[model samples]
Target: MERIELVKSIEANAERILEDFTEILQYLRSEGSDRCDEVQNLLFATRRMVDLIDSALEIYHYLIRLKYLTADTQRSETAESRDRDKMLEEMFRELNSNLGV
Candidate 1:
């Protein structure tokens, strides 16, 4: 697929993951010890989903910065975009320090 199309797919996947994450978080909050095991499994699944979304957003943004995708040709972001970008930057910083690469 073309760069723009690929970016759109990534954005769509990110949005879907965000929605799922929100729902899972709500479930986690309401769950008590009676559901600890089940909640733990769902939380693990949610973490993986979140990681996938984070990775996709990072790649898509990197491509945009590298001129693979144009700035104006993209999906709209929620207010959380800035926070998410900042968090991803921090994560990369931590990883760089740990790997020393």
Candidate 2:
């Protein structure tokens, strides 16, 4: 898909995940019952969605580095850009280490 569409999809998915959390909070506050296990499952789902969002952000960064941010943007990435990429890689490494993934 096109970059803009992909970005929009990512944004929407993030929003949906947030909404799911909100719903979970609402349910817990109002109908706190034997649904604790369900709420826990929802939390796990939220975490997975967060991981997917991070992956999407990484893809977006790569696309931006590829000079696909705009049709007229022919500028080269700087050393800071590479540094940012390294930082993101390290972040993912730490995340995976924590998850044993």
Candidate 3:
């Protein structure tokens, strides 16, 4: 399969996973388990995953813009996405800091 096709597939899957996290959050809220701390940690991790996936999609688009991938793949090119990706990347350094792992 083509690289663009593969990237598009991945982007779609990432979006689905992100959407699932919303449902998970809602369910957890409804449950209001005693394990609130653990649930909060898991929610943070989920947010991080969503951010990472979003950044990945943006990076793939940047690759396309740089001609590393086909120019025809994505037509929009904005600095905002790159800035957002960089912010997400910066969050990685602090990701496990509070987790103590």
Which candidate leads in lDDT?
A: 1
**What TM-score against the true fold does each predicted structure earn?**
0.39, 0.35, 0.35
Give the alpha-carbon lDDT of every model: 0.68, 0.65, 0.64
Candidate 2 — which residues are off by over 4 angstroms? 1-33, 68-101
Best by TM-score: 1
lDDT of 1 by residue, 1-92 (tens): 56666667667767776776776666566655666777776777678677767867776665666463444343335336877999999999
Model 1 — which ten-residue stretch has the worst lDDT?
68-77
Mind giving the per-residue lDDT tens digits that candidate 3 earns over 1-101? Answer: 47766667667756766666665566555644468866775777677666667756765664555464455444335456777888987787578676665
Put down candidate 2 lDDT per residue, 1-101, tens digits, no spaces: 56667667667756765675675555445543557866776676667657666756765665674455554343345656778999999999999999999
Off by over 4 Å in 3: 1-34, 68-101
Please rank every candidate by lDDT, starting with the best: 1, 2, 3
